[model samples]
Target: MRPQQGMIPWGPNTTAGGRAGTQGGEGAVELVMVNPTEQAAIPRGGNSLQSQPDGKGHFGGVHGGRFVAETLMPLILELEAAYAKAKADPAFQAELAYYLKDYVGRPSPLWFARRMTEKLGGAKIYLKREELNHTGSHKLNNVMGQILLARRMGRTRIVAETGAGQHGVATATVCALFGLKCVIYMGATDVERQKPNVFRMRLLGAEVVPVTSGAGTLKDAMNDAMRDWVANVADTYMLIGTVAGPHPYPAMVRDFQSVIGEETKAQMQAAEGRLPDVVVAAIGGGSNAMGIFYPFLDDSSVRLIGVEAAGHGLDSGKTAASIERGRPGVLHGNRTYLLQNADGQIEEAHSISAGLDYPGVGPEHSWLHDIGRAEYVGITDGEALEAFTFCTEMEGIIPALESAHAIAHTVKIAPTLPKDALIAVSLSGRGDKDIFTVAEHLGVTL
Candidate 1:
């Protein structure tokens, strides 16, 4: 079923097609979706961006569609069809749920940040501990879901891209479990910097290819992965790492990761007896943030905040703060906010954290920002570094640097809120892979 803005879109219409609406049980099937209230308000030269696609598979309104070469377009279309069929099948959902519980460790805790809350002294903070997942990051949520769909499509191999190496490791881990041949394209720079994760992927029986063009980060790596998928279209499955890319991918990845928000909603009600006052996560290609933000879109009382990477500072001309600083543009096969210049050429993004160093974000986030359903902000490397230290020392949680960005923003806003106010942070990944970078930044040897 198309994930709409509701507590549970899995009612009567979830199968065969979602009801007109899942909750209200009215409307057409909108997979890359939005509630009626959600639509693109941002005008481009006087026209509004298409925010919601109907049954025709318009994807993410005007912001997302298949924007690839004709040869690759057919592959994307086939994947979309396969996914729709799989979602409608009871067996597919059953098996996916079973593996999520038995293998990838679902229902990640929404633990109250007792120490951090007391330390902040204002808002109560709860962490959706996605870091505790088997692969140590939220990336596996998407990888596993896509791989299952890939298998059903009769695809025999998997190809993916990674930046900080967390995704690469996660993809490789799952590939080995299913005995699928896996190839992960990573930036040459990332392969060198995130060595632990690189070694982990290699040990998991996946081939890692390093791309050297562009700034040697996620975007470059994605380009290479897309190329590989096109060249080997018949047998290869391109497992996109995040909620970016085109059409069904952003929608597909968001649905897979939505489990984070799904669990958080139940856990928050169970923990605090009500919904959180605010939900926060860092946005790179925006999957983690989307996972946590999607469920709460219709809750007017709850604030959804996305923190982007501000490499040095927003004004430093070296930031990955796309939603905050970018204008409308197309990149990586979908139209979305992008770091571009006067001539509309894509600019390289800079962030100390490899995972957050992308020039574009998931298209749904772009739509959300335009519609004012969510807020986007920027956190700098220095601030994120300090936040990383805070979580490590104060809470004994050495968060992934990308998660540190959200933590940094949390401390800034949480302390300013009322004492009873609540904030839920998606601690999206663990810090083991980031230890080397953190140590080097601190001028210390590990």
Candidate 2:
């Protein structure tokens, strides 16, 4: 990686790691999918479906391509074209901006946690208050945008998958606003734990389907949603909640959720007079991280940090530290880094935070990690819980378990940094939903 003007790239010794195939296998490439019922060769015309040139030679790769069966081809193509048109339209951009500001509440504050920072004794820690957004999380940001796009494309039904039920609630809320039918697939365990969100989605007139396959978690929910899509692709639009999906979903989700970065930039300038020395966010499927990291991509002065959930610890195979334990593979419509066995069977990831128990990350995250544009770290479940407790006690802020991962890093690094150095963390959501779970973990009986 070529060193930018004043930026200090972290991770590997040298930034540049060579081309696309540098780390992967060599010689002629071929993709074949074999199943119990069918076998076919995956099209390998492109190096990667996601790796298209973005004119600037910055490598705008599309990780997932449209690989649906022939029955859904026409509908998928139509939606793709509509997205292309929306991407090129200025009016669409303005409309989204208006909604973000007036409806969803844009420009969320970059709050300097004075009490917490003083207690930590190091860096000036700031919180990007995404938890204050409508529906109580950053998930609403992408849901609103996608539901709008779905409406524009004349789709009458929306389908989505959720891990902790936050995304399902957000998607259901948007569908209610647009008067479209919404169906969300959620894991049985999550539904049991996040009953409030499940109830909220139903109250919003959306159907909440509990998936029982496999471990009955995010991956199973995703598989159920995909099966639903393959069955009802004609009238349904799948509103993916993360930046890890195939093709346009990852790119589209990132673009919609990027308001976090946009707001952080402006708020930091007004509050601190400059960019932050570090921007930290928790990465599940990488949506929140991308949202907070996108604006800082070209801001060479800012350091990007992504925190992944280390269920027990990175050394523990039970952890959800994808960047730490995963390898490049295709899952849920994209070829990215996934935590799987040698035979490609997905592993069950454990995290105290249901939202952070994902086995794979976004392709852009994988690319950014490889290119050394961002640094991915892990925080153990105990550390995250400690951070959650610390923040609540010191700052009166109860962060979601997932967001606590970022707070954990801030706690570790804040005490060591100079007073002038600033840190911004994306508080992805509120912790009201996790109170019971935390209590259970802490052995505090309600």
* Candidate maximizing lDDT: 1
Q: What is the C-alpha lDDT profile of model 2 across 1-446, one tens digit per residue? A: 12131232221211111111111112212211101011011221232322332311122332345544566566656665676577556666667767777778865777889999888788899999999999999998888778888888878999999999999999988888879999999999889988998999999999999999988899999989988988887688988999866556776787677767766776776676677899999998989898888766756778899999989989889899887788777788766777889898989988999999889988778767766768999999999999999989988989999999999998988888998889999999999999998999899998
Expressed as tens digits, the lDDT of each residue in 1-446 for candidate 1 is 12233332212211222211112212222212222111112111211222143343333344556678888988888887898777656677677777777888886888788899999899999999999999999998888888889889988899999999888898998899889999999999999898888899999999999999887888999999999998999899999989888778887788788778767776777676778999999999999998888767656798999999999999899999988888878888888889999899999999999999999999788767766778999999999999999999888898999999999999999889998898999999988888888898999997
- Model 2 — TM-score against the truth? 0.86
lDDT of 2: 0.77
Using Cα atoms with residue i matched to residue i, what is each candidate's TM-score against the true structure?
A: 0.89, 0.86
Model 2 misplaced regions, further than 4 Å: 1-76
Whole-model lDDT per candidate: 0.81, 0.77
